[model samples]
Target: MVNILEFIIRSKALYTTWIYYKPNRLLFDVGEGISAALGNKIYSIEKLFITHSHVDHIAGLWGFINTRNNAMGSREKDLEIYYPKGSKNIEDYLNFIKKMNKYLRFKLYIKEVEHGDIIPLKNNRCLKIFKTRHTPGEKSIGFQIIEKRKRLKPEYRNFSGKEIKEIILENGKDEVLEEYEKKIITISGDSLPISPDIIEDSDTLVHECTFIKESDRKLRNHTSLDEIKKLLTYISPKRVILYHISSRYNRLINKAEKELTESFKNIEFHIVHPEEISII
Candidate 1:
């Protein structure tokens, strides 16, 4: 059987944790209890990407750090974390945590990222980070994994590897240029209607739908069903997973599913709940 590519640890509106891997594993948004759910294993997490500094989104950092410290001698590599630059009180919070856990034995490398930055992953693939409109306290961001492609030039399609090399050596030049094609999986963590540019042509869009219906209430930092529909129309992703539903909407999952399915028949729609996992 083929290994699953993605899975969710928790999918509630207030908290979430997603795991993605093929060659390298990653934990996204380490909410509460995430370390316990992972069974104290520290080697599986090669990198952690934070979408924002919300308490619900980062409550598991302490647990994760403690777990890594406990497994310090056994771990083969250091843990790397990436988050938005200059967002919230993250620095102060992390400093406090570090001071409290002063005896911990492992290294935690934290890096701040900004929009349009590309983080290299294994196998020549890269994750592109982009900014999203959300609470000012936490600069929200989205991610897209891109793969670089190389193919023979149209004029040299029939040339063998050896021949191509010989031609380059003889001519002292080459006709190859890098090309990029991406299988983008975007996550809009706890945001209002995201900008179209943030999720354009994504293969999978994991978006929050806190409210299933339109509300006249002054817009807060959450998305509604109508806004999600408009996002779908604009991005047209292959799969759209709606998550982060409010606790009050627990009974409305089926209704939301029915309405979304009927309205967007061409797209694969999934209403994910806490503890539910999805492999993309």
Candidate 2:
């Protein structure tokens, strides 16, 4: 069976964060310490998507670019980075990185994307961006991987398997199904509880659960475990991988994970501990 998601992720609130999605060679948020963790695998990444310019979310860019250019690996593989369109901080930081690496050996491309924008990928998949509420005056976004497919239309759902096969054999499959898009994965990059519609029916959701305890949150920016639970009441995802958790919740993490698993029996739950890398 094909793996739904193959990723190495590390996240700690206010510290550093990054996700290396192996299937498509996509890296999300090049936070500090990522280079030391990913090492040679950095050369395999084709694109890096930044949700925002917060230091914790982007501090690794400098090291990543420098390492890929100088480290013992192929230097000809091109690297493309996509960030929110209105993020001036990321634009400036990318400029600084380019300036510092004047003798770079590879092609470094940077593009600014916004909500409702689509970035095409290989294997009939694409990435879509949606606006998110992170910090006041800071423009943040979330990403989802959508796949184009054809599925049986609602009007054809009641047909028996044999009858459906006969219909398809006679009329062709296109006559029984309609073209649609399926959201296979989503990343909630350091934002408030993502809207339910944005994540509904996803195969996997990599959401930021920064505050395990609701009372610990002072601002409306970061998400809490309670919010995630509430969000689940509206939509169902096959897997919910929680990350970017605060270090102070080390003791509370186990208990929270147990409860989450118990309550959402159908959804697999994963917690990315602060001090270690989670391979999934």
Each model's C-alpha lDDT? 0.73, 0.93
Top candidate, metric TM-score: 2
The deviation in Å at residue 137 for candidate 1 is: 4.0
* Residue-by-residue lDDT tens digits, candidate 2, 1-280: 9767599998998999999999899999999999999999999999999999999999999999999999999888999999999899998998898999999899988999999999999989999999999999998999999999988889989989998999999999898999899999999999999999889889999999999989998988999999999999999999999999999998888899899999999999999998889999
Model 1 stretches astray by more than 4 angstroms: 1-3, 15-23, 40-42, 71-76, 151-178, 216-218, 275-280
lDDT, candidate 2, at 247: 98
Off by over 4 Å in 2: 1-5, 158-171
Q: Could you tell me which residue pairs clash in candidate 1?
A: 11-274
Q: Over the full model, what C-alpha lDDT does candidate 2 score relative to the true structure?
A: 0.93
Tens-digit per-residue lDDT, 1-280, candidate 1: 9855565546676665544443457777877777766664446777888888888888888877877777544544578889889865677778877987887555678899998898988877788887877775668887777777666567877888888888778764445433556666777777887777767767778787777766732568888888888877776888888877766676778788888888888887888754455445
Return the lDDT, model 2, position 231. 95
Report the lDDT of model 2 for residue 220: 89
Compared with the true structure, the alpha-carbon lDDT of candidate 1 equals 0.73
